[model samples]
Target chain A: MRKKPIPGLSLLLAVLLVAEGCAPRIPGLERTSTTEAAAVRADDEDTWLKAHYRDGRVAIFDSWQVLQRTVEGDGVLLGADRDTLAVGPFVVPLDSFVLFETDRLTPGRSAPGLAVMTVVIGVVGFLCALNPKACFGSCPTFYAGGDGDEHLVAEGFSSSVTPTLEATDLDALWRVRPVDGVVVLQMKNEALETHAIRHADLLAVPRGPGERVLADGAGAFRAVSGLNPPAAGIAAEGDIAELLRAPDAKERTSLADSFDLATREVIDLRFDAPATGDLGLVVRSRQSLMSTYLFYHALSLLGAEAGSCLALLERGGMGGAQSLLQPSEALGFIEVQLPDGAGGWRTVGEVGETGPLALNVHLLPLPAGCDASRVRLRLTKGHWRLDWVALATLGEAREAVRLPPSAALRDGFDDPETLDTLRDPDHVLAALPGDAVSLVYELPPGDGDWELFLEARGWYLEWMRQEWLGSPDLAAASRLLGDPAGSLRRLAPAYKSVESGMEEIFWGSRYVRAAR
Target chain B: MSARRASIAAAAAALVLGGCAGAPGPRGYLSTAPEVVHTARGGWVKVVRSSADATFGSQLVVEGELLAAGADTLHVLTGTGPLTVVRAPRDRVTLVGLHNRAGERALASLGLSILSLSNGWYSVITMPLNWLVGIVESHTQSRVGVLEIRDGPWDACRTHARFPQGMPPGLDPQRLTLHWYWPSAPRGFSTPR
Candidate 1:
């Protein structure tokens, strides 16, 4: 948890690389001459011999033997008058040759790149200074080999920042079409944080034709058939026609009010109540990273005590709810409200979970005998990106078959016991920045439709940046971690200072983009 | 692992992989004068000639279009001496090599390598590695014939000669460009075991 602060180490290294690349490429300047005895002693089949004559003639031999007075070898006589003339089996007197030499390594291609870089670098100069303050964001990034090249499938437990806040996160491995009986999930820690993954289990349920298995707010899987879009959906801006019509990334969001991030906004949708089975309000949405920024800023406020402060949360140092997770909790869920059919709107249930990187789909099951014709969704302004909102007809709850990872590998080295560790709640597969583990899961071979949900239980620790140091706010830290609504109101302007750049900075973590 | 250890490993990987980028791949060569007949894929030849001094600075070089090579003899044509023939003898010949150019690529690589310095501490390792890759890629590659550099009664060299069938029936050496088999030139690349 404790890291030493290094100053100017980054700048020094950048300058050093520029210098190495900037060095002059003088032709044959790298060639170092050796004595005849040194060349003979080090000579072998792999050795190449160079004969320098007093008459200014030079030749290279592929193989040679030194006689009492004559050097007899087979190789080429480099003649300027023609192609390097090949010669051999003939004896050249030691007296005729001024020096005999050999080189172990070829001066690989003299990089023309160095010369070009030197000029370009000389002109551009140092553009980025070595800033030790790094942008912070991390989670176990999972790639199902489906999310385009750059897009990640899911980031595990994006909200779980500490041991106390560690919770089992469920993510639908969206867009994955499993081939054969295998599903390989590449779990990567692409940030400056340590991930302690307790377990990664593939929870799957049979999905019949035209039927989708979705989890409710309480993590209960429901078979929802005929998910119909709202007859009409309207938000603060206008009709939510193109945006919230489907689970596309095309989302509907309102800007944060100038004064408060907690300002509330609602979208009303009219749906034709399915007179048959139980109904559920299906909402697929994700947080806006505003909460993530607040969390990091709060940690920065803690400064030197960041580690100790987190340890306190883990050890119950700051009592009550988790201070780090409080802002997210204050923003609350996407609360669904349906008309009582008596002029007032009554609460139905809530949908959505935390995580700004991936979309969360939840079935907020409507209470029996309730009118599902009209619904209103209430949420904090700019706090969420709603991708889809629909009314689904729910069926019976189905039991799931858990498929645990059969093997875990990193760089081709197998660690099969990682399977057992993933099962045990007490153990964790720890991953540092740049570390990656492939979790291989084998399912029963079948053509039947099955939806896979990743149940990743873990937590992570963000490595503090130097920019976070020197500022310590104890009372404010407590208020932020425990009471977000109150502190959010006071910290509004401060949050605004970084609101515009936070998302870009958080996503563009230096460690995350490291060469894979 | 500590961030320091992870960073160290990353740097090490960068160096090893970077060195590999410019590593002599299958010794590919591009001929600038493709129209001319050449024994090797590339006909350009550089002969490093060293005096008794043997110092790098004391060395001079003769570079020209390769003509032909026979057993213990090399013939080259030079444009600098007003389209003359050069007959370089084995005794005066030093190191001989055929070369290629990767100047443009090397320069571009250097530019990008310098730009990567913005990556903070990572630049220290990446910068030099980038430059190395560029240079390695821009190598003066060795060809098959050059790789097997030994006494040549080479069929290709003989065929590429102005007098492939050993001097013509009525052609005179003085009338045609004088065949300079052994000229005042240079040496070979040396290696330790």
Candidate 2:
């Protein structure tokens, strides 16, 4: 007797067929040897380990070696130890290292657990789909503050404010409030504490201007727009003044017909210096196009000049030996000098290799113990046109400003205008002290389902230590704060009935709102 | 079950199985099978023409169909004309049959469309997933094949001679030559079963 066909058999068959179809197939005629396959598998294994394991965390083991004998460290496993296992600074040969033991954080081993959790969640989701209301009540929808006078105080409040002011000191407490559709900080200080500072006033803090001197023909040095070429065998000292008087021309020859100098020919530029601050010279130069074009086309052009040009190009055009001479190679350097108190010119720095068709600022540092009052610039090598020279005061030596361990609490403040001002790094540096500052999003009353999210923006461990919030684990910290629902929870008590949806709902690093 | 209902179910099952079976695996000049070449009588064939001289490199790939199969030479109809026959020496030329799955390509296109429809809005999450799947799928399949030329042009005899209607647009006959080549026959060039 023929048996009755099972229901859904066709569907099952279809699924099986699909699975079989999608199953990876080995090419019929292709021969993948055991060695090749093993090599490929080893490569894949190494790749997986590298991707999942944090640097220096994986343990390396040799053949017949136990886990205890494995070399464990916190650096990344570079690759399979064919010769040596390169884990950062440490390297162990393949004869000694064979196997890899993944760290706790490695996703490969933990993937099975995650997959199981995903399946469990999927099953729960299927059940929920059949009986939605039984699994969860109406999903709470949160809205920002509308037109209302009732202000709900933001929870998890911590402030940098303290009453440590002297009798004459102005102790102030700042808080942002939406006024006339603009978020302005209301400052509470000793004299006029209740006044609200304008958003513009809070935003615009005056920045210290940089110390720079623009030397445009108006300086103490004789500014020459153009100069004539020096006569042959002219003294280096005389040629220096002649070049200084020459116009800022593209080609070295155009400034003065025969500007090319013999070895050690010095073009001295003198300028009066300032009394204080470290002085630096900036030379604005223009590189010629002919030098580059000639350099590249030297081989094609047949002549002694072409040969010399080609040689120069190979030896890094005109200035110094660079890698390659491109069409944009208009670069040259000049030795800077300041009087060495010992009655001689002291070489401070060399500046050049300016960009093509653009003003290149070459900063020349002054020599140690040199007299800035007698600052001078001397061109010793390569032909280049100088536009103008500026004396800039280098930044003074000051203690490095260290950013304090800070945490930016991102509540439901989606106000871009206000948030931009609040989150500005410059504004934070200027306004707040090295203490915690709360950016409270004062919502309208009756909106009970508000979720709070805490973001450890920078230096999380240090911030946690400072706050005495115990471990960096979000769930543990939330539990310590009398929050039973954990870091990922909903504000409403009705939503707290189901913890299965918590992973999906609280996707990122967030604090679950405590049930009221 | 009733006859009509069983027929409907059977039809549905057949349709799905047909879709899966007809799905095109992958397409490339090197990956073409000999069976495909035999069946593609009037269809286009990509021919890699090697030079008789060893010093001068005159290797080129041309798209044509078999015009007349001789004992030693293959008269192929090239882009120039039917009269402009390319006398490809049987020993010097390699012929590969191209088979592109239209249905499988449609399915893949549909799958990509669905993925794009869902993930286009949330690209941050979907983009990575899409890339990962793509990488995995690409590594799993053989997209390109290596053409292995043999001593005799007897392989051309297995392929029938027929005049093709016209060449497909955007098909560059000259540029279709395989990037990789060997002086002699390479492995995995056995006659298709």
Candidate 3:
């Protein structure tokens, strides 16, 4: 349909360009009287100006006419002998000076114009040709509107695949920074799934400067300090101490065992044991696309009957089917252990966080009496990607205040139902496909800094895929549900064939990056 | 490079863009397929084959029967003489589309839509508006589909390759075909039982 372009769109674009092109200018570059300019002599010291003289010679001055009636500047001759007449510092009487000026530059208006135009055009193009808002999402994908754009901080209850399986998932809103004591956390159901959200709130804890509120594996939040990076980290691939030394995105991920998706890989870490108080092993990591593969493949196996199957699970008709953890049961958590002096190892605790959109920070605080000389992490070979690992001096354990949405907006209009559903335990905010609800919360006033953890409680049912209907592998689904380990091994060859493209099809959806 | 060059480039761009999208061709007619099947070769890629720099390596929606997709390169069978295989950089190939019946029904649907004026002058807006809406909605839905891998590790699309395991492998791609190197693959999804 070749409809004529709307004049309103052009006007909107023009306004955007104008807004972008308008940048704040440096003060005092205005037109001023000679007396006023003379008064600001100190300011002129930084301003470079070209002085034209009555004589054929030219001079550039930093301190224009500093002395009574003359100025000292680099003497430049513009005649044929200009190159030969060495340029040097010389003084010229103000009487001989013809002009006093500084080169003026108009900021590149086109650059801003092009940028605004590109953004405007890109947005229009996306709206017309792409559905960025309908991309990959599971559970309640939270967006704390920070840094001008919506920054994805946490995804709540990502592991909960159905209503009966719903669990409370905690995620540190590390990237979120409250503005004027307010944080607007946007909850969006961007995937083709029905998300039943019961509680959407923030856990706020006070912390001092240079201190972070980290979650311990035992579900305790603590303001930890003295972050000590591991001295050495030895993985199956090789040494990865350098990668684990910082919370940089440069991660260490290993290849999956072609046969068993649950194959464990160990990374032995050596940390300089702190002399005094208790410590916690902090691990920064995110899940690999393996879970996404299992989930999607399970859906495919369920095939055309997936919708009905999921509906059945929702109604509690499928017995304990809603408790389906599948491949994750074999590979979900990361085990942390300490080397027993007698060459044996003692299990300390396990750190588990789901979703691949953002990296999670998990602190496995060792028991007070346990030794922390050496630590070994046992996790599924390719299931987890580590960004950083450190031992922190555990400070005071703090409780977070849950702040629910002060106001809620679904898409754009005020949604009282979402607010009610989130607050009332009996009712659930069942978000359907393409639903974007912004939850605005005002951080409680008080303190130097606050650490926020997103407390999202919900479960979602993935919509049936039309493509999967072509070949319904119900037997595969049953095996996946019944015997995960064997099924994962048998399905390895097929999964490997299409593994590389799975992330693109799963998490790389425009919906994940959709504007709030 | 220069003012004159920029203006000429802009003019050429407008001229080329002007030729794309109209009442009947590849625009406002098609809706999302009720069902779509992956044809191997990088999920049925539909690249805009172009030679101009202004296009940034995109132009017309060329023949979308992707032959073989690797990590770096994409081989698409252009429907030219002898069905020449047009090789493009995987990164440069932006569009990926499924070969739905949109091509077959597009002309007929469009022709009938033109006569949809029997509904009165209101047909002017409704006919094209509905068609364009369908196009937009379809593309958006396709974005999250399994085969819509515009941002790719391209290796998986190779599953759809004529030689799924690439041209060389010990019977790669899990598909059995022979050609000295390997046997020819069967036309449709023939997953080894």
Candidate 4:
């Protein structure tokens, strides 16, 4: 088929459409799209926008058409009829513009009403950009209304872990060590008391802050962190008997001035009024009991009624001494006795208390090489107070470390053996051999007469008590008679008694034995 | 008034117009093939002999024999020298040809192709916008007789029909299979079985 072209009418219509600004109909939508139309409008607005965007710079605007805004370096550019606006980096919509301005197309003269609206919009835009609520039409994301910029801030010293000092027993020696930042005091029990140095409550010297003081009343003390010696001195001021002596030189030095002479190892001496005029004590010899030697002496208290008392004193030794006893040694043996020829003896007067009697004893000097730093005294008779005023010098061979006599006399009335023996009618002290002492007393044939005899070696001390002196044969018979009960009753008028003397020695050693 | 004068005038006008209207001959149009090529090293197809009667607008339907042992590949004879390979979708074989846009549209709109049926093979109706006559020469057995792209209800001018119903011989509809290939693939397209 041949088609004829009728171009005149179509060409005329196309020209009319182009001139009228009616675009060609696109395939889909007949009307012009707003996107395409926006491009057309941009042509005129681009000059205003170009100054802001030529190098990809940006000017923030409050409204679609106003130019008022804070300008930044790069942003998206939007154009409307007669104006162009630059929106900053955000993606806010055109309707939400808060602060904007009108950039006048004519440089000098701004559009009067539009320019005012632009400035108004510009203020709003800047506020809205800075403050989201103005632009976003909602409260700022979280908390917004604070003045400028401020916030809340958190607010307490940790407690200390100090340790308390406890009182300790001070009877023994102690040593101190600081190990691993802790101070430890060790005792003989071989246990260590560790104190954390940092955690302990620090005790400082009065003036020195570095020095630490710890007083555990147990005689333990320490100084930490500095060189400060502990205060050392004896706390008590009285004399104490050292029974178990320390071998240490330091302990000896401590005891030297602290103990009295009687408390050191030495023999004791005492003196009393002699019972007869011109009486004297004699030392016959010195002998050894073990390794130690002692001086011996025979002592006599003289009086017309003293023979009976002196015999009792010999009986107090359980037997008289073998040799003359030293007066210093004989001081402890004070008793009176009456003897029977049958080798029995009886105590008559107050032998330990105030008897005129005498006996023998030996004085033992402190042994050679013996550490006589401690001494303990014990008495078997009366309140034996001995006062020593003599100061002696030590010898190369042997030295008598003399001590004041501690006088004690015990009355042995409570002793059942002695008491029963005294009460028995048939009991008799049998005759001893020629060499042994006869500890015996015989009663007289008649009443009220008694005698006691004490024999040892070749020495004899005999006491005869006679109330039958007017009858010659009766008096001679009384010389060989002894009844312990009758003799005690017969001599009860005497001031010193044997029973009281033994009680003193028995009670005096109670403390000494316990401590030993 | 004279025959010689009229011929001479006509000759002169032709000469003048030839110089003015001699637009440059259309440069040979090079295009990416619609069906991507997948070729083994030696596989090729060429126009061994072309009809002198064929003109520029003449339609061509060339289906090279593909005896693929393991996989199928295509070779398009470029007419320059060698054959160019193309890829085809799995389960569907491709035929490369040339046709006008109106012809392709007519086939797409009407669901028929005289050329495809002339050889007794089914030819696919491609997009009307495509100028190439390349067709998917396979029919999906599952979705048969259904018009995939149809004209609006009752508009005969916008013909509506199923793709690839009628075809020429040697390409059976049962033997041929339509397989969807991802469009962007440069090689034979295949979907997981």
**Candidate 3 deviant stretches above 4 angstroms:** A1-135, A146-148, A273-275, A311-319, A411-413, A503-516, B1-193
TM-score-sorted candidate list, best first:
1, 3, 2, 4
lDDT of 2 by residue, B63-146 (tens): 554443444455454534332234556334444333322233223323432333222112222323333443333322222222
lDDT of 1 by residue, A107-152 (tens): 3333444544454343323322211222212588777663234345
Q: How would you class the docking of model 3?
A: incorrect
Please report, in order, the local distance difference test score of every candidate based on alpha carbons.
0.60, 0.30, 0.58, 0.21
Q: Where is model 4 more than 4 Å wrong at Cα?
A: A1-363, A380-385, A389-393, A396-516, B1-193
Off by over 4 Å in 1: A1-137, A146-151, A272-276, A445-447, A503-516, B1-193
For model 4, residues B76-149, the per-residue Cα lDDT tens digits are 22222212233222122222111112122222212222211111100111111111211221111111111221
Candidate 4, residue A283: CA error in Å? 14
What lDDT tens digits, residue by residue, belong to model 4 across residues A318-375? Answer: 2332212222233332222223235543332211111111111112222233222222
**Better candidate by DockQ, 2 or 4:** 2
When candidate 1 is compared with the true two-chain complex, its DockQ is 0.08
**Candidate 3 displacement at residue A320 in angstroms:** 0.8
lDDT of 2 by residue, A1-516 (tens): 999888568765664455455433322221111111123223222222111111112223221212233322233332211112444433333224222322111111111221222233344445434222222211110112322221111111011111111011110111123333222221111110111111111111111333222221111111121111222212343433333332232223222112222123354454443435455555655332223222222222223343343255345444322322222122235666666668787776776542222233345555444455444545423235454454545543222112211222323333444445545544321222112222333332342221121111110000111122222333332232233223112222322233224223312101111100
Q: Ten consecutive residues with minimal summed lDDT in candidate 3 chain A?
A: A24-33
Question: In model 2, where do residues sit more than 4 Å from their true spots?
Answer: A1-420, A423-516, B1-41, B51-58, B68-71, B83-152, B163-193
Candidate 3: deviation at residue A251, Å? 1.8
Taking the tens digit of each residue's C-alpha lDDT, what string does model 3 give over B62-91?
433444566756554432311223444343
DockQ each: 0.08, 0.01, 0.01, 0.00
